[model samples]
Target: MQHSVMEEGTAYEPPTYDETFPVLPESASSSSGRLNIFSINNNLQLGRITITQMFRVPGEERKFDHSDKFGERESIRTCKTIMKETNTIIEIATSKDQSLTFLITGKQNQVLEAKRRILTTFQTQASKQISIPKDHHRWILGKQGQRLKDLEKTTATKINVPSVQDQSDTITITGTKEGIEKAEHEIRVISDEQI
Candidate 1:
């Protein structure tokens, strides 16, 4: 039977030793079917020193059963969660193993913040917030809302600019802690540029 061995599970088999007289070449052996293979990789002479071997684990092997269905299911679940939880619409690309890459488009700052938050929340398990000044808010928000829109698109964070009547100078950032820091830092930098 043809079988492929994978590095998984817990089963060990010791290799049998050759105790007989050495009358033949090293390429020939009679023992457990562990194939020790050696070859000169490329045309270089020094490549002959390294040896490679293929081993068969009696019953341990990996079979990939799910293909597109598994990835689609995971993507759907993640998309649903992202839509329901946040005010952002994001496109998801998933690998066969259910890994995700988000292609998000929205306000520049919001997007950047969101990406930052998503990365940090899943990768670093951190959370935080940042505040932006009202005067500098115009810079972050930009002229005719273009600059602000650009900020949202770049940061991936929803930038909440309080109305003149709100009497608040702080622009609230909602996303992952790292994202918040990044968005906040960018806005501050923009503010500094105006001065």
Candidate 2:
């Protein structure tokens, strides 16, 4: 992992347990997965963050007669409600070109949850069903699902390629219609490339 970043021209090295991190006592560790993860990531920064995301509403969904760009300020209302519920900070701005900008600041999980909710609720999302051999699911998911995460972030879609246990054949994709098609095509491409 360290060597990979070095190859990418990162000036400083990522922290390792040798110097900055602490080793936990056997007695202090427990069975809870989340706790174990928190301990491991303690060396990683957990500071608050502020991010801005901007995008224009699709023309078909635009309501020109309305005040806001998309004519659906419901997205704002939903986000505000989620912020209040999660105790996160979210500020929204509009642009002349029918764009909506989101200013979000909060803890790591808080920001992620708020942003996900905003995107899923506000955007034009759809679900598509694809049947791939259950055994091939892992190829699409990749190791620890890093591949699927990358695909989602790249295509702005969510892909559910079934687990080994369920033996389910149907993979459900939920996102923009375009994103679904992109993800589906990429999944097939990945499967083909692997072969």
Candidate 3:
């Protein structure tokens, strides 16, 4: 079969890096030596998105209770670093009504990471603490803390059982209400086990 090499007097040419995309600057990486995304594929998702989060501090006096509010305005300012780590930009506006408005924008992954980090960092989260006998701490911790790790993963919580040396009886569970409940229940059950 005889076929023409070119159609419409135009021949196919493979795309060069410069043609397909722009050249990335060498200053992409920070001093910490983190690997930055130099360039993204043309067809790949740049992953841009915007998210808004609203927070209300309890009581109008703004007495600055740790559990009821996002903390003093200065503390909240420190959390901005978390957003920068994820390459997200944020604008926070506060009103006399004791409400805070957060506007975050960035790549999809960046936005999501920043959102979760910011909430867990500044937002008032639920926590539960239980007293487990010092002797039973080993059982809950298991060998090398594997059991505790598993329980934490399942419950989606951070369980802080004081070091065996500290002589502390409190097993503090910090996370969502559901997570705290699950972890607390599981801990009590484990401690009650006869084995």
Candidate 4:
């Protein structure tokens, strides 16, 4: 048998079988199961977890009264903001009965913080309805509802003005007792100006 010889002062290198076996594609080599295991391990190391929570919105504060033009409800917007601020993920689903279910994912501390903020924001609150002339609704709404939005922001309340089609003069304000009182005062001031 002939013996193979390596050149002196040269390091030995292993032979590669380039064509013997087909190289696996990146995706094939990293199977989803293995990646999932890795992800689980990483999350364990990071103390990440997912939790589900359900909250019942008061009947008086439904989306019809608090949604923006895009139809994103106020609670949804608030959750999204909380998610960003707390470095968490929040998924909101509205039930047929108007309850909100939140799927929150993050580290334990972050998830708890998000939950606390959401609970505080959506806690039991007061609602007040005031009557104004239908004609003055336009003035209270201002151009594209800017005035109404400003009043809500300033008073920390949600104000729902009846749509023109509804033919209702009732305006709904929902928030803390102080907020409702402030908003009521403001709405009355605006309506009185229309006289």
Top TM-score model: 2
Better of 1 and 3 by lDDT: 3
Relative to the true structure, candidate 4 has a C-alpha RMSD (angstroms) of 18.1
Number of backbone-clashing residue pairs for each candidate, in the order shown:
26, 0, 1, 0
lDDT, each prediction:
0.53, 0.68, 0.68, 0.70
Give lDDT for model 2: 0.68
**lDDT assessment of candidate 3:** 0.68
Cα lDDT of model 3 by residue, 70-172, tens digit: 5466556655677668877877666656665557677755665665555455445687779888889999999999999778765657889899688988899
lDDT of 2 by residue, 1-195 (tens): 354435555587668754574545773465242343334555666545545444444534333333544435565577669899766787766666655666667775566566656667656577999987776788888899998887876666788877677878899988866778889999888777766
lDDT of 1 by residue, 1-195 (tens): 997575788576644445443325654664444656788557765323332221111111211124424234444565456545555566645454544555655443344445544443333233344466666667776678887666655554566778867767767775444446777888788878877
- What residue pairs are clashing in model 4? none
Better of 1 and 2 by TM-score: 2
**Model 2, C-alpha of 135: deviation from truth (Å):** 2.0
Winning model by lDDT: 4
TM-score of 3: 0.39
